[model samples]
Target: MQREGSPWRGLGVVTQKELSDHLSSARMLVIQLLVVVTGVVIVLVSLQQIRDITAEDPFLLLRVFTRSGEQLSFVFVMTLLVPLLAIGLGFDLVNSEHNQRTLSRILSQPIYRDALLFGKFLAGLATIAISLTAMWMVVIGLALSALGVPPNGEELARAALMLVVTIAYAGVWLALAMLFSVLFRSPATAALCALGLWLFVSILWPLLSGHLVNVLFPPSATTADALLNSLSMHQAFRRLSPGALFAEIVTVLLDPAMRSTQQSQLAAMGLALVEPGSIPGAPLPLLESVLIIWPQMVGLIGGSIVLFVIGYVVFQRQEVRA
Candidate 1:
């Protein structure tokens, strides 16, 4: 009874169904409205700041936009927003189906379990992309109107890269949410667990790292400089968190110039330059900064993919009752 055509036929059909369902959902409308409103607020604030600065300068708008962009990039917003949105969207993905007694009927169709999961994941990702894209457009338009010129080619390229990084960052949370949805019988439990994980990674983990380092090496005058010269517990803790990784990546991409600042500090610290002249005065290249962040991006994205795959496998094998 199996069709002899493409092996992905079932997957395609499920994806279509998922997309259709998402498009018709009221949730999408509400999310879009919120994103638009937030974007407008950011632009208005930036414009007001520009007005408060030296008004006669032609480059005033550019300076203001650059400063604003540095402060409110896509990555920064995604770091804060992705977990909440992903958890809300996915915390009940499976549990609700079972609660409504629809899981049995869905499984009775020709679609494979893998297809169902894949479809749902793609649909959620699509929703995130749409919301982010709309926000980015609004920001860009506001920048253009306020600045009186379009963004340069390099700036545009960076903005596009920022968007991609944001989506990938959101993927990590979405996968985690899906995993919890499959693992927990109650949607509320899944959402709470997701929030707990977010708090641990974003806030508690860094605080614990700082406390542990202080305890391990109580600061002496000499040891103070040495401890400061050593790895930054803050940076190390940040590297441990996906949100921090996302922020660093966005910063590096948007302002490639900051690479020099990072390199200078690293050189000064790596060489134990307590006197500040132990290392040469050469600045770091933009390429080097990009190279440093590339591994971090790979790690975060890979971790997200691995988690998603694990969740998918677990969900596929799960026994659902009507």
Candidate 2:
């Protein structure tokens, strides 16, 4: 007979121990320092351009998170660097235990593999959470203190949403790193694989997306067919890369005047929508903003869960010693 609480037994202990190790580790410190440094640089470098542009802005505080007109934005920095941090934390998560001759020993205890995997993943996520939270505070604090403008209620709510979106995005990378850690026995192999995925997705995927889109939607089609094909290709291509999905979400959240799509709505309202891009207008309500990017948020969160589940299944089926 199975014990009633045995499945979840020691879950908390394992999570706490792993989380503590991550928090106190030198690696975490270095990653966090990198985040802090990058955040400060973006804020300082873009501060002037953002100031010049948003001089009359009501939501200037939120601009810190989104403004990258003259330089890379804060969120952009995260998109580039956070994945590396995640990979660093997770590339060795499972394989290191095996290398240390501890996996079999740990499983020989009462703890379920379920608990062990969940605990370790949670710990890595917690470390990422800590890093993100600190960076959020530092970036906003510097912006507010420098600009001398406190965040309005709407700004606060939107910033919170942005943070949630960011965490989900980071989780996808963390899960991928863990998946690699599980699939590859060598820690270096896992790290290199994860890093390779990051580079290809972040750097090469978009270029390929463009070429593929052009090849699939040639100029010979009718105008209406071309437009439809273009729109469909754009959406499909955007969904292919988590980077594009995240960028779109952040753009809508941070820049209130930014009205990228919704041409029909503008046309219905008898507004002259700009041809190049939607003209700047009053910022959308928080509810409206979230509704606009809800699909992207779901894609990011869903992708993370799917990756995590794959890792979980692989971990469960593997020979305990491996």
Candidate 3:
């Protein structure tokens, strides 16, 4: 029979402890410092450019900020800095506990293994979400103050959607790091493995895919159509890389002025673009852009969840002693 009011049951205790630990750790301080440094740099760069521009429309200023920030600021932070931060926090989560012999004592408690793992995972996720939200607010505020333009309803909605996508992308890295931590006994080994995986997926995978395509389908006339057929496969394979997915999502979300210039082009390319007459039109709807990214987001997050579940099951079944 389950107790009605007990707080230390199953996963709750684990979640609470993990959250407490994260709150007290140097990990929190490091995350804060990174966000501050990155946000300040973005603001400074934007301000410098704003001074050089002659146009003074607030809306135009806002648009400039969106374009420049999306291309230079957000993409760099999300792709490079954020993944490193996530790996740093998670790469040793399990190994550190094991090294300190705390795992055996924790398992000796009444809590279930699932609870312990779930709590820690949830805590890590919460920390990520909170950190991201803070940085997002800073960006929005800086844009508003510097540009002197309030965000329209659609702009606000798109900002929210972008933030969610960013979090999901970061979560993939965090989960992968956790999986590596559980698989390896030493924290250093786990960290190295996680970083290696990140580098392969984010940087090397694209180059390898391009090389394979060149070698296998060498752009001959007969193979030209074959190359077109292989393009989708290449894209699908590249989608496995989170960096590619994140880039595609950012391209769609940040550039709202993209629409088909003409019906013929739309029919030919199978993508809508900004009409010729609407050079300065409102961006595509937030939901529509998000829909474009749905497949990539699902693939990355689904892969992460699958990996985490496998790690969880393996960790739960492993033997541990004091």
Global CA lDDT computed for model 2:
0.81
Ten contiguous residues with the weakest lDDT in model 3 = 258-267
lDDT per residue, candidate 1, 116-209, as tens digits? 7877788788778888889888977887787676555556766777778878888888888888888887889988998999888876776787
Candidates 1 and 2 compared: the better one by TM-score is: 2
- Report backbone clashes per prediction: 0, 0, 6
Residue-by-residue lDDT tens digits, candidate 2, 1-322: 6655566778899899999989888998898889899778777876876777857788888877766553576656777887888888999999989999899999999888889988888888888888888888888888888898777999988887887788788889999999999999999999999999999988898778877877877646656556555756756785688887887788778876555543333444465445455335656678877787888889998998999999999998999764
> Which candidate tops TM-score?
2
User: Alpha carbon lDDT of residue 14, candidate 2?
Assistant: 89
Q: For candidate 3, lDDT tens digit of each residue in 24-52?
A: 89989989888877766776676766666
lDDT (C-alpha, whole model) for all candidates: 0.71, 0.81, 0.72
Sorted by TM-score (best first), the order is: 2, 3, 1
lDDT at 21, model 2: 89
Per-model TM against the reference: 0.80, 0.90, 0.83
Instruction: Please tell me which model should have the higher lDDT, number 2 or number 3.
Output: 2
Which regions of candidate 2 fall more than 4 Å away from where they truly are? 1-6, 221-225, 260-280
